[model samples]
Target: MTFLSGWGRTAPTPATLVAPRTAPELSALIAGASSRGLIARGLGRAYGDAAQNAGGVVVDVAGMEARWSLDPDTGVVTATAGMSLHDLMLALVPRGWFVPVTPGTRHVTLGGAVAADVHGKNHHVDSSFGAHLRSLTLVTADGTSRVLGPGDELFWATVGGMGLTGLITEVSFACVPVETSRVRVDVERTRDLDHTLEVMTATDDRYRYTVAWIDLLARGSRMGRSVLTRGDHARRDELPAGADPLAFAPSSRLPAPPWAPNGLLNGLTVRAFNEAWYAKSRERRVIQDLAPFFHPLDFVDGWNRVYGSRGFVQYQFVVPFGEEGTLRRVVSRLSAEGVVSFLTVLKRFGPGTPGMLSFPMPGWTLALDIPAGQTGLAGLLREFDEWVAGAGGRLYLAKDARMRAELLPVMYPRLAEWRKIRESVDPGEVFRSDLARRLSL
Candidate 1:
């Protein structure tokens, strides 16, 4: 047994870790799992305990047959779930293709992507990752592999199901064609949250991707001030002379120090960082490579260590449209509390996919990265959870580490339906995780 924790570095638990290199091996391991049950793990990018199963088994899918082949004619690619988006981008971007959806980071595996049903800055247009999936092979609790598509209820359940429905063996999806890796980005600083939302609602249709970096620690008139960056993939003609349009290379500038004292990212430091980030983007309509625009943090490997060994808590919640008041209230509360959330992002979500428990909807979603070591942090978040639930908002399961159980049904109204479908396929409930146990999912 070995200890494992999520990217947040909280709640370390010991589990029997097994890496199966082939589908058959994984199937056999699942069939012979011990009473502790099992769950699948990918790049461990989730900020919570979704991947870790205490005293249970964790089958690392990274070793699966992850080779991928693309059909340029149809823009479709098939590969095992273990393949990382980082690898996929390197291979596909150079060939004038891009993943249909990508989160802020590219280190996640295809399985994790499907399970989380992750959304990106383009969610207002492209929807979540599960929406682009053509078909997938699911290994159920009975150790049977079934090829599934959109029509199957089991398929929908597995998507955003946090891997509790089954272990994904293979995935086939459609990739979008891009002319060049460079994105023509337009950036501006918003005076406050209302102005930011107004600008996004009025003109977001002009761009394919939009995201706002919010300064949560700001108070008074600037409480929810943000920097909005919107852009779409630049055409080959937009590039300067002699530049390689399809050139794809992402280099890490440096890794975060191996260690830092807990509480390193307090109000004072995070306030300074947020101010600097906002000030540095005074220039508008800048051209940047996809890495810098979409995955800027990727430039610093192991950057999570900057939050210190205690790690941090990521609270991501969404309130549907017409609930802007609730959104404002939450922002005000966070600001009043002086919460040191360094990378709080606010975005507008579009229509959601059929993943029953998928996080996004037509709404406003805010993601906050707060230091877990902060005093009274859990209580403050719990209070916020109640407020969010009351406002008909839901939290993201992929990033949840310490949410209460009762809110699951309150937030995800389809919980009962999802459980029914999941039980039909996993009668024994062989596939489980700490998250499933915590929320009683």
Candidate 2:
């Protein structure tokens, strides 16, 4: 038996972990473990119990690494489920190609990304990860492999299904073209909630990627103040003369000290940091390397340790279109309550994919990273869930750790349809995670 946990390191559990090097091995393992529960695990980047199963078999898909061919003419690349976006970008970016969608971190595996149906800063212009998936090769519970495409209901079910339907063995998707691995950015600082919304509404469409970092500790006149960062893929001409187009120098990484006090990130410290951060950023345009622009936090390895041993919880929720008021109200409540959130992000999403349980919608979405030990944190989030559901919004299952089961249906209205499809493919629920049990998925 092997012990495993998620990035949050909150609930460590032991399970019989099997690393199947091939698709056939994966199928046999699933078929053999029909009575006992089983779940597929990728890079274990999910922040909660989504990847952990207690007293069950855990299949580590990271070992099934077999890179397939890429059709240059069609701009489609087929690869095994184990591949990470970081590796894929390294292979494709030099050829003037980029991923269609990428989350904030590149450490996530292809299978995990598809199962989570991740979204990025460009969700307003593009969509979730499921939108770019042309097809997938799934290993069903009965030890059979099948190909599923856009029109197939099983494909949509597996997308954002939390790996409950089946094990994804292979994935095929289209890639976007890029001139260089850099971004041409336009950044601005907003005075308050109204100003932030006004600026985003006025100019978000001009850039391919857009996101805002809000100061959650601010209040009164300064409530909801943020720094808006907008950018497009940098063209070759946008770089300085003689810059190497294909060269990507690895950025220096700073490690967080092993032992940081729990009280290090209190409200006073966070408020002061927010003030200095806001003051430092006025409106300006700059060209930055892709690493810093997309994955700034990545420059600090193991930075999650900054929160200490208890870890943190990331609350990401999307409110429906024309419900910006709901977003404003939630931010205001958090600010008034003095919740210390280090990073609060705001983005606008376009239409979602066909995945019944997918997270994105045509609306405004906000995500915050909050320490877990804060008083009444769980109760406060539960109360916010009601507001989110009332506004026809839903929480991102990939980032969720403590949402209640009763709220699942309210958050995902199409859960019934998704359940039907999942049962059709995996009637006995052979694929199960702690998250599925927690939410009764």
Candidate 3:
């Protein structure tokens, strides 16, 4: 059996990995695998076990390199699931078109993005990835390929369903138009908790994309202070006089050292880094490229290696709109307790798609990347789950690694409906993943 793991490189497990270069080959493999279950894997960017299925057959769809075609009149693009957002951007950006929604990283495949129903800095304005999807081609356990759309229950289940429903073969969606690949940004530094909340509430809608970088190491009166950045796609006139109109070059990236020590990111080091980051962001109204603005971490190739071999876990939760107080309480608790998360982001979401397990809602969402080796990290996240459920919030399954199965139903009120659809399509549970088993999905 071949061994494969997700992007996090944790919980490595053995499986029979098959790379079928075409849709027909993928279908034939699934049709032949009646005894062993199958899970579809894309660029393997899921930060957890969502893409890993132990002792089963894993299908890697990344090798299916099919190009995309656009419907000029409607701005709709149909592409194979194996296409990466990075590739899509390069093809569409020059034509005054952009993806409807993009997650923090552009390395994600189209199928992975849809399976995870990824959301981005603009989630508050444009919901999750599912919200923009027009239709999809799903290859079910029985080896039949079916077209699913907004009106179909199976469509909703597959979105944010973690690939349990079926293997997505193709995706069709409408793209947003943009004048240029540059971003006209406005940056603001907040002093404390109250100031952070106040600034976000006051001016978030003025920009198309918004996010806050919290100083998690701060304590006492300065706890929860953050640097907020907001921006909209730049117009051609916003560019400098000598800037190239057609070519937008992204900044170069430095790769992380493969042999970096495990203790390189301890409290003292993170605190110092946080201080320097906060001190340097005092400037406002910065002009930046779309790559750096939307995917700063992607600039550093293999940056996830910074967390060492233990990998890391991203804890993301959203509390309802009226429950901002509960959100603040949790942030305050994390601050007072000194949890030592190197990256903390806060955003507001609008509504969500009908995907039974979709992770967005009308609320405030916060995501923090914590090294898995941190003491009591698992237990602490479990505790946070309780607070999130109490406030009618849920964790993002794409980023989840250690959530309780019992709590999943509480977080996602539509779990039962999703399960019904899943069971109908895959009655024998032939399509499964480590995440589906862990969360009882």
Candidate 4:
């Protein structure tokens, strides 16, 4: 038996692991799954239990053969499910094309990205990954492979369905045309929460991508001080003369230590780091590589290990527009309590896909990483969940670990619809995961 957990490295459980090279092999494996059920896993970047099946079957598809072809005319690419966004970018970027929407990391697989319906800084302009998907192939519980598109109900169900409906085998999506792999960024250091929100709300429309890094530890008048970075793909004219406009090589990663102490990232250290970061950042406009602009954390291998052996919980919740009060309240409480969040980010969301369970909507999203072993953490987060739900906000399932089952329905009003579609395709519940069983999805 192999023990597995999500990227957070928390609550690992033993399960039988299998790697299938082709759709036929995968279908056969699923058709014969035991009562314990089965779940698909990719690069395991889910941060939570969405990819884990305790005492059941966990299909590792990252090693599957990747077959991809790009249509240079339409800027569309069709590829197998196992292909990672990293490889996809390496291929597409050289040809002056980029993925329409990318989350914080490129290590995620195409199947996982589709399943999660990930959004990035560009969410305000491009929406989530599902919005760009043209079609996908899914292997159902009955071992039948079906191609689904935007017009199909099952397609929306599987889009952000957390892989409950079926196993995704392949995907096709349109890519964004880019004149250069470089980005022109405008940075602003805000005094406080209100100022930050005002600046972002006023100027975000001018850029294709925008994100704010919040100093959650700051209190009093300085609470919610943030650094907003907004950028777009640089045009050919914006680049320096003779520079490679389409150069696509990302920097090498610096691996974190194999292990860290439980208190490695405590309040003191995090506060110091936050202070230094906030002090050093000044308002400016500059040109940067796409990698640093999009996936700065990706340059640090095993970065989560810095949170210590006890692991950490990534809390990400989004409140609809006009609920800035809820966002402020959550930020104030976290700051007042002095909870140490190693990383805190805020982004603006735009329109959402038809995927019933997709996490994005027209709203403001805040994501942070807090040590799992912190005192009163569970109760504190539970309180935040209530506040978020009351404001009609929902947590991101892809980053969720310990959210209560009751709030799932309240937060996701379309839960019943999604569940019905899930049942129609997986009646026997052949597809399951720790998350599915945990929240009764």
RMSD of each: 1.0, 1.4, 1.4, 0.8
Q: What is the lDDT of candidate 3?
A: 0.87
Query: Candidate 2 — which pairs collide?
Result: none
Per-structure clash totals for the candidates: 0, 0, 0, 0
- TM values, all candidates: 0.98, 0.97, 0.97, 0.99
lDDT of 4 by residue, 1-441 (tens): 999988888788999999999777998898799999999999999999999999999999999999999999999999999999999999999899999999999999999999999999999999999999999999999999999999999999998999899999999999999999999999889999999999999999999999999999999999999999999999999999999889999999999999899988999999999999998889899999999999999999999888887888999999999999999999999999999999999999999999999999999999999987989989999999999999999999999989999999999999999999888988999999999999999
Model 3 lDDT at residue 396: 86
Model 4's lDDT to the true fold? 0.94
Runs with alpha carbons beyond 4 Å of true place in candidate 3: none
> What value does the lDDT take at residue 64 in candidate 2?
80
Per-residue lDDT for 1-441 in model 3, tens only? 887766666677888888999777987887777555889888778888888888898888888867799987788999999999988888888887889999999989999989999999898888889998999999998889999999999999999989999999899999988877888999889998779988888899898899999998798889888999999988889889988654655567788888667757778988999999899998589778889899988889888888888877888999998898888788887877778787899998988888888888889999998876777777877888999999999998888878889998899988899898998998988898888888878
User: How high is the CA lDDT of each candidate model?
Assistant: 0.91, 0.88, 0.87, 0.94
**lDDT: the better of candidates 2 and 3:** 2
lDDT tens digits by residue: candidate 1, 335-436? 998988879999999999989999999999999888887777888889889988998999999999998999999999999999999989988888989999
Clashing residue pairs in candidate 1 (N, C-alpha, C atoms within 3 angstroms): none
The count of backbone overlaps in candidate 1 is 0
Model 4 residue 298 CA deviation in Å = 0.9
Off by over 4 Å in 1: none
